[model samples]
Target: MHSVVKLADAKRSPKWTDSQTESGSDRRFSQHASDLVLRQVAKAYRIDGKRLPVLEDINLTVEPGQFVTIVGASGCGKSTLLRLISGLERDFDGEILVSGRNVTGPSLNRGLIFQDHRLFPWLNVEDNVALAFESRRIDPADKRRIIQEHLKLVGLTGFEKAFPYQLSGGMAQRAAIARALVNEPEILLLDEPLGAVDALTRLYLQNELQRIWTQKGVTMIMVTHDIDEALFLGDRVVVLQSRPGRVRRIIDVDLPHPRDREDRQIARLKKEILADLAGEH
Candidate 1:
């Protein structure tokens, strides 16, 4: 099961500060404070006294609210890169800095959503999302409010009582997204979160993701095999080369959000990316 580490300082109050005007109708989640920077990051594993490299010399920077997507052929270590960023794997070369501080382990500041929903089969939507706050010191009322706000953010407002089995693939993914966002993470790392859904539902979720990203202003980095999805949602796309994954090229979408899928530039870039992927061995 996915979980967030508790806030380091137990005495510090919860960051979800709520204030009300006379009408008592305004509520907001705090914006993230840190941007992500990775410098010369490389990882390797040992197999029977032999070293196997996965990622090599990865250097990238994500602005505080920018959306960056990564694309590559299989075995290029896209998911491995996300694991390193999330601090799930610490044994690697180079440094990953967030706000000039090293990322040593998992914290609530970064949230990761896998391709699978990973929701507990027996837990309802509400309970699954609430799992993120299990180790938090937040008040019960505030936690409840945050859960509801994130559920509404992902269009799962009425399905709070539903279990994973009760939802369609798209709906389950939405619930996964909501659970990932419940902690108001500084950066949301998605490892092919939309890969399991059907075509039409994937398109709809793409729009929904953009809307949520616009509203929340959380920095996002996603890895996907879909070139169209990468172009439609990314401000920049980083392509990787296999055989000890390295940055092959970084293409700037250079287009605004809510981009049209039919844009000529997208079509042109798709051809280029396809050729690049096809040429890779």
Candidate 2:
């Protein structure tokens, strides 16, 4: 049997420290300081010569190295909002800023993860991860070292030769995550990244994600439907209301890392969020 990569044992205390920051990379999250600001942001789509707004007046801030989760009903434009922050949806209105600079387009400082793994089938794991650095002008040796470090960070070091088909759902997602982080982005934007995995694997990968977030201290803004997952992982949870999506509320988790699933405070907050959502209907 091929050696399966175990997600639980995959993460170690990250050895890639602040001193190793790539040249010209701002390394904004090193001291826990990647302030993300969104001001009066609005997005719309046109159909049949009519404008249909998807998001409206979205204003929020994510502190550096903070884990911020967004939860809302379908059509609330959660994913669309993330797209704006990623600079993929340039058609939107208003301002998006990271570390006080306007986000005109995507840069190496921002990494994005979609729900699907989206790895190239023909590319082996290492090559797939390597794709993130195609435009970088670094030494080949440095690139190889960065890739290896990220693979270990995500727990796929030994499976570098494996193809996407050979990896399980969780492992494929891990590879995708590695690809995103290899650039050492100051912020990672996640769009329901764990939604496709099985229940058990989802739980395991959530732990792995927490470890990676802690070790790398990268600013993260993730969209998830699971209230429990949001509260567990997020320092703050932003809820949006649909029909021209808008910020309904922002709830603070106020819990420490590696939180217990059964904590009473989490349960209470969950009820509050559920009630808040139910009221929107």
The best candidate by lDDT is 2
Residue 117 CA error for candidate 2 (Å)?
0.8
Q: What's the true lDDT of residue 184 in model 2?
A: 81
Q: What lDDT score is found at residue 41 in candidate 1?
A: 98
**Clash totals in order:** 0, 1
- TM for every model, in the order presented, reads 0.88, 0.89
Provide the lowest-lDDT 10-residue window in model 1: 1-10
Q: How would you encode candidate 1's per-residue C-alpha lDDT over 1-281 as one tens digit per residue?
A: 01111111110222222222222221221346357899999999999999999999999987666689999988899999999999999999999998689999998989999999899999999999999998789999999899999999899889999989999999999889988898889899999999999999999999888777766667789999899999999988999889899998999887756789999999999999998889875
User: In model 2, where do residues sit more than 4 Å from their true spots?
Assistant: 1-28, 31-33
